[model samples]
Target: MAATIRFLTARGVPVMAHVGLTPQAVNTFGGYRVQGLGDDAERIRRDAGAVTEAGAFSVVLEKVPEPLARAITAEIAIPTIGIGASPACDGQILVVDDVLGMFTEFRPKFVKRYAELGSEAEAAIGAYADDVRERRFPAAEHVYATASKAGDVA
Candidate 1:
């Protein structure tokens, strides 16, 4: 990861390093486990340092312990972005779907739903369907006047 970050940065590409609870490596880690816990703190610390030294402008710490996240943030010169990490990090990130309560396949422990837009959307569509079925839609006020040829209208 550090090597890739370095290569990208060397080519003038801004790199955002991702540490802890890497979703892509979920299989290797045996599931979505929080990283930087207990003895793993040292490893995570090293990872953060390596990433920063590799020229990453920011790093996302996911599902790491709050204290470890704080320490990593302090040790690194770049900004630390937390996902499931801690509020002490420099910043935070969340998926738009998670925030809007649209994607419900599985909810992470850290995600906080701000709105139930999915349910609202479904209700709205059902209402529209009912209106159309009852012939109550396309009411005169909801339609446009047909175009008239020149001089055809008085």
Candidate 2:
């Protein structure tokens, strides 16, 4: 991972390192569970430091304990972006779908939904389906007249 970070940074490509509950490794982790707990905290800390040393401009501390995130943020030279980590981080982020409440499959403990757009969208789609079934959608205004029907021919 450090080699990859170095390779990207050396080529002037900005790298943002993500440690603790990396989503791509969800299967390896068994699930979207909190990381940096007990013995694993040291590993996360080391990973953050390694990325920073390898020239990562920022690192995302995801689904780790607040204290661990805070400690890593203080120890690392790069900015720490938090997701499910605490306010102690340099910045915070949440998935846009989660914020809009559009993803109903799974809700994480840290997600604070700002709107219930999914339900509203479902309701709107249902209304449209009803309109189609009642033949109300193709009202006269929706029909287009062809040029030949209007007596124009080339």
Candidate 3:
């Protein structure tokens, strides 16, 4: 991770480092849960230091204890972006689908839905399908005359 960050940042690419309860390592961590707890907090703190040392401008602190997040934020020179971590972070991020209620297969506890767009979309699609089935759509103004006609009836 640090190597990639160093390579990218050296090339003028701004990099954001991710640590604490990484989704890709969910299987290894025994599923999605809070990281940087108890003695492991120090490990997470060290990881954050390494990330910043690698030239990353920001680090994502995900599913970490609030105190640990605070410690890392204080220790690291770079900004900390939290997800499932608390207000101690410099910034916050959430999946767009989770925030908009578009993906509901499995809702995490941290996710706060701002709108039920999925249900709205389902209802709108149903209405559209019904309109098409009942021939309520494509009314007179929706169509145009054939090349053989000049504003005449079909």
Q: What TM-score, computed on C-alpha atoms, does each candidate reach?
A: 0.76, 0.83, 0.78
> Total backbone clashes of model 1?
0
lDDT of 1 at 109: 90
Candidate lDDT (C-alpha), each: 0.90, 0.93, 0.90
Give me the displacement of residue 121 in model 1, in angstroms.
Answer: 5.0
Higher-scoring candidate on TM-score, 1 or 2: 2
Order of models, best TM-score first? 2, 3, 1
42-100, model 1: which lDDT tens digit per residue? 99899999999999999999989999999999899999999999798999999888899
Better candidate by lDDT, 1 or 2:
2
lDDT tens readout by residue for model 2, 1-154:
8999999999999999999999999989888899989999999999999999999999999999999999998999999999999999999999999999986888999999999798898899999999899999978776666535556453
Model 3 agreement with the true structure over 13-81: per-residue lDDT tens digits: 999899998999999988888888888888899889998999999999999988999988998999999
By TM-score, the better pick of 1 and 3 is: 3
- In candidate 1, what residue range of length 10 has the lowest lDDT sum? 145-154
lDDT of 1: 0.90
Candidate 3 clashes: the total is 0
- Show model 3 residue runs off by greater than 4 Å: 125-154
How many clashing pairs per prediction, in order? 0, 0, 0
